[model samples]
Target: MAEHTAARPRGRPPRADREQVVHTALRLLGEVGLDALTMRRLADALGVQAGTLYGYFPTKRALLTAMAEAMMSGCQDAGENAATPREQVLALARGLRTALLAHRDGARVYAGTHAVGPNTLGFSDTLIGALRQAGVDAAAAVQTALLIVHFTTGHVLEEQAATGADPELLTEIDDLHQAIAQGEYPQLAETHKELTGTDFTQLYERGLQLLTSDVP
Candidate 1:
């Protein structure tokens, strides 16, 4: 009798890799938002077993970190043609904000992840170099860069959060306006327009200016 080899199992083929997993996860993030972008969901989207993802990203946080890094790609290039250190810093800040605003919940996706990937590192190095060139000390330059990043990320988080202006948020704004009009808070009443302003673009630019004003 002829020897017979066992047939290969008929099932879903393994098709996911690190890049495809991150790419699909990011797509799912945009589609369903971060909270709903689970490993099982990603695997299902990729037509693979949930355990397959662990081979590419050991944990959810690892996957998120990779996604964050991918989102930050080419951000530092925005400062390439900047004329001054201040301009370079501002360019980088604006670039970061733009990057964070590119996807739904992008800021939340990047907020707490410690991504040491090339793109993130390049952005940090370029920002710090600009700060140092503007006469800031080594430690202070690093700290200032962190402050700028924190401010940019935090501002983008609020900006993204306010994108739809839900009913509850509108009600809260109305309540604040009424409360300020009561005269119990004189200062708030005096600056009520600024307090209730919805011009995020203006606010973001002003904030960037203030953050970089002392640079040079």
Candidate 2:
């Protein structure tokens, strides 16, 4: 409502239409993986021409940037009242995992796409501010925060590609095991249980612990 104050303009659609297109794009990206989410498909999903979609996003890069911004919005929704810099950073990491987990190839969609958006910038400010308050130098604070963020995102992306949302990977691992001969791949054969049994929740918590602990 606030975005549509419309001081002047009768021929134009409301700003909400742009947001709707962006949201449609986000959903399409979720349903179909990023590789398949073309502008034409997004327009088809939204029942608009591909040219209309370009009014909101002139190029594939712009569409992707919007989706990345949506991911940041998701982070803001999760980052409410995060008290400390570490907590805020951790909140962002958790938020990303949550968003990517919801989509078919979510982590892949988010990977290498960290353009500054409202949510990310705010949370970043929160984390970096906390670090500065704790007497950390600016360079160290930024480097530490980015390191943790990248590690969290990279780990989740690998997990998503491996497991999907349904834990279908367990079934797939059964097939991979057949290729590992005891005599030739003893290390892998022996560690198969450990590798398969472990889940991302444990991995995330442990890595979070290590990253935070290493920060000081």
Candidate 3:
């Protein structure tokens, strides 16, 4: 005389998973930015009820973390097969920037979240392993990994902010450039063209060199 409970049905599944939620959230982030990124909004975009998202993320912070992790996932390829620690780190840095620049307010979204997920942690491990292989101490390797991330994220944030500036701000910048061109500022005027130009790649490479110069 025992009561039997039926097993949970494993049908075709709910047609939603953490990956789909992250994808939809990323699309929404690119469309509406981080300020307007909400579970409700994401669910609406995915054509699912808001509560269903909670089943995957449990909280808004969780979703943001997942998004950041997903963003970093593509960067793993940068360091996967690099021949040297410096190259690995450089590739990782460039890859991170590329990924961040791919979405609207991407750097802001990534910089604002702490993603300790598999993909994020994997990238960290790759960097740390490379540094360790290059003879850096364990603690310093970890710190260097963090430094690379912070530097790349900060640089991308600034780059995106500048590139996305409003016309009014841009006009102000142009006016300032003209004023500087009039030789009101000697140093800035001397390098006006270079200053006004976009050479983030060189700047980024220079920074990476500074970071990795001492490594062997």
Per-prediction count of colliding residue pairs? 0, 0, 0
lDDT of 3 by residue, 121-188 (tens): 87778878888888889988888888888888898888887787457768877998989977668899
lDDT of 2: 0.71
Which 10-residue span in candidate 2 carries the lowest summed lDDT?
7-16
Scored by lDDT, the top model is 1
lDDT of 1 by residue, 1-216 (tens): 999999988986878878888889889988989888999999999999988889888899999999999999999898999998888999999999999999888999999999999999999999999999989999999998998999999999999887743568888888889988975898898899898777998999998888777799
Which structure among the candidates has the greatest TM-score?
1
Residue 29, model 2: Cα distance from true site in angstroms: 2.5
The alpha-carbon root-mean-square deviation between model 1 and the true structure, to one decimal in Å, is 3.2
lDDT of 2 by residue, 10-33 (tens): 554323377898787777776777
The C-alpha RMSD of each candidate to the native structure, in angstroms, is 3.2, 8.4, 6.8
lDDT of 3 at 48: 80
Model 3: how far residue 75 lies from native, Å: 2.1
After superposing candidate 3, which stretches have Cα over 4 Å from the reference?
A: 1-15, 178-184
